[model samples]
Target chain A: MGLEIINTLILLLLVVAALVALRVKDLITASVVFGVYSFLMCLLWAEMGAVDVAFTEATVGAGISTVVLVATIFNLKRKSSD
Target chain B: MKNTSLIPVVLVGFLLFYASTDFPEWGDPQSPASSSPVSSHFIAKTGVDTEVPNMVTAVLADYRGFDTMLETVVVFIAGMAVLAILRNFSRKKPVKRGHEVSVEPDLIVTNTVRLVVPVIQIFSFYVLAHGHVSPGGGFQGGVLMGASFILIALSWDLERALTRFPINRCMVVAALGILLYAGIGVLSMALGGEFLDYAELEKVLPVSREMARYHAMLGVEIGVGFTVTAIMFALYANLSSRGRLEGGL
Candidate 1:
């Protein structure tokens, strides 16, 4: 019951995060928001008892992917795009 | 928001939300995935065969070793492909951009990294070595290990990170990791069993078949960890530096 409610909340947050990440003109800001999106998805997976998947998500999605995105952004100084 | 696009997005969202009602409740024992024969077989015999508490690792590294081996190769191929593309392009045609000044690592960031990097590397090894009982294994551990190097790059510079783990050396280590995996498969085959049949490793190791499988799985996981760690840092190095292998983000 409470768990289901929390799941719904997280899912709602995920949708908002995705939308914001998509609509943002600044790619770097979008990357950071996508990191938030990944972390929320990780939490959702953890709540669903997929701890291994969640762990992978936490590390790869939130940790390494963020670094890669930031590094890529360094190459492109003009962060904003169409 | 524009009405046209907003309508489609909202409609799709509502449809998906409505559809979710028919899905199985969380942790449903009768869920198709949980009730499947393959899952049941793994649950029943994973302990008997591999003596591994973590069935995910046992199944991934032992029961389905071939697929994981191919997956490691895929990671390696990705690193190599990036190298081929970026390294050659830089050599053929050099592109110049506006002036960008290099900045020194922040005092706080460098100091914090100095304190944390050791712990992170140790934790990565723990995740790799303890996967038999824990929720972590090669891929996750490898990512953590790679991140430790990346942290160094972030706090200091790419040159400092490359000094510790050079690009050429990373490639060697990556290949060696794949070799370690394929070598185990070949060894098992030589011991009169099919490829990747870890139970046959008992002939070489002073352990029972089950224990041999357990130990072999650990080795294979380590191989995977090596490849993933190397490829990850390699990718960061090449991409961030535009294959110049000098200045980086």
Candidate 2:
């Protein structure tokens, strides 16, 4: 029950972080925050016993997607105003 | 950037919440996944037929071999796409204007990353090699291996790094990997029992069927690993090196 409560809290925090990411003006920081959101989602998946999907999400989402997005940032100009 | 869509967002969230209600309880041993016909078959026959310790690998290499082959093709296509994009645009001269300085330090903190990279690479190989008896497999290990190169790229100059590992060679290796996988399948057909049937190869190779299957699976896994690792690094290189040349402006 304690673990369940903690998981719920963590999920709530992730939702808040995602909202912040979406509302943020800086594209790069927002992308990084989105990556963090993906990682938190992976944890939620694992907690739900979807181990295989969680594994894919953690690797592809946190690892590959982050690298790709960071790389993409090099090609674009920084600081987009909302 | 600040378009209001609160109703749609709330509706989507509610729909997702509703869908979660139908899902099985977390970690319930008697959940449908554990009790399903497919899982039951896997649990029962995996040891009897494959004799391999890892059930996930048995399913991936033996039962779902066709899907694995197509996945290798997808990796090959990604490598080709990266090469095409990089060759056309990446090699073009950067438009020079004035003095631009890097915010990040050019030199790494120490040799720690360099020292750890080989260890990580070795672990990835171990994961790929022991996949038959372990949880890791071609796809997982392949990405881990690819990450080593990305690390190197991060800590070093892109121009010098490209010289050490050219994108064109990576593309060739990726293509070769897919072809090698198909070649093995064709070789199996030539030996007798349809394409990709390892049992037939066992009969021709004078080895036990189980051992032959193990060897064949290893071959395909290596192919997948190489193709995936190469393609992933290629994409990383192309994406990271845009607008930068051999020497900084």
Candidate 3:
């Protein structure tokens, strides 16, 4: 089904996003990637008919969390210590 | 070290996949969750009891109100904790960093944001008010509202944003939100019903029991929105300024 393909693609991208968020040395890049991961998860939730959860994911997870993370990053070293 | 860690990660990933196989298929009617008496009861009676089209909102703001109240409290406490830890009250000059430079906000960005902020705030209100019939509710709406303020901070500066929404006012608004939620519960209780029994609100409002619940849910959501909006901005303001509450990203 078309829905299943979109879901599968999103899931794959989620994995890539997650891996990139971890692998990236730049904290700002990682935070932005995490936002992408959250948005993909939101799409997955919406696809599965959890609209309320998806909304929360889009707003809190993807939106506010990204801004907050970027704010924190600016106040600290931009690069990962490890 | 990273390569060695990947072994455990891959193993855990496989273990999760193996564990998930035993779970019921998605949306299976015969699944334990789908067939549970509680879910069935909610699905069957939520409309009758609350007159709310959105069952998720009904369950969150009415059925599980106590839990949501505490969740709001948790958000408030987290903001307070961050403030306590990071807020700088000592009278000392901030050391100028290499990156710290006075710069004016970009004209194009400010103009674009000026046009966008009002729409975002109004949309957030729509999301909050229309939650009973739609997918959104307090948390999503409140986050959107807070983000509007953060956008102002981003486009302009923290001082300009704070001038609109002062830090002390933020705390007052956050606590008042909890008070409003609990006050409604107490009022319903005072009207000869158990705590948070919104049906008792029928005594005061010229509406039926179900309608009373519907309106009460909206009130509860407003309380949640207030706390979440204020605390969210407060969190960003304090965190970005390292509690000095002046400069921002």
> What tens digits encode model 2's per-residue C-alpha lDDT throughout B112-178?
6688789878988987898888566777677877777777776765655567677778878788778
TM-score, B chain alone, candidates in order: 0.88, 0.83, 0.95
Positional deviation of A41 in candidate 2, in angstroms?
3.9
Error of 2 at A82 (Å): 21
Off by over 4 Å in 1: A78-82, B1-25, B89-96
Q: Best candidate per DockQ, number?
A: 3
- Binned by DockQ into CAPRI classes (incorrect, acceptable, medium, high), candidate 2 is acceptable
Listed in order, the DockQ scores are 0.50, 0.34, 0.56
Candidate 2, DockQ to 2 decimals?
0.34
Each candidate structure's TM-score, on Cα atoms with residue i matched to residue i, is: 0.90, 0.82, 0.95
Write the residue-wise lDDT of candidate 1 on B1-249 in tens digits. Answer: 557898888999999999999988766889988899999999999999899999988888998889999999999999999999877543554444443447778999999999999999999999999999989999899999999998998888989999999999999999999999999999999999999999999999999999999999999989999999999999998888777777667
Q: Considering the two chains of model 3, state its CAPRI-style docking category.
A: medium
Which ranges in model 3 have alpha carbons more than 4 Å from their true place? Answer: A78-82, B1-14
TM-score of 2: 0.82
Fnat (0 to 1) per candidate:
0.60, 0.28, 0.72
Q: How high is the TM-score of chain A in model 2? A: 0.82
TM-score for candidate 3, residues paired by index: 0.95
Using lDDT as the measure, name the better of candidate 1 and candidate 2: 1
Selected candidate, larger DockQ, 1 vs 3? 3
Ranking by TM-score: 3, 1, 2
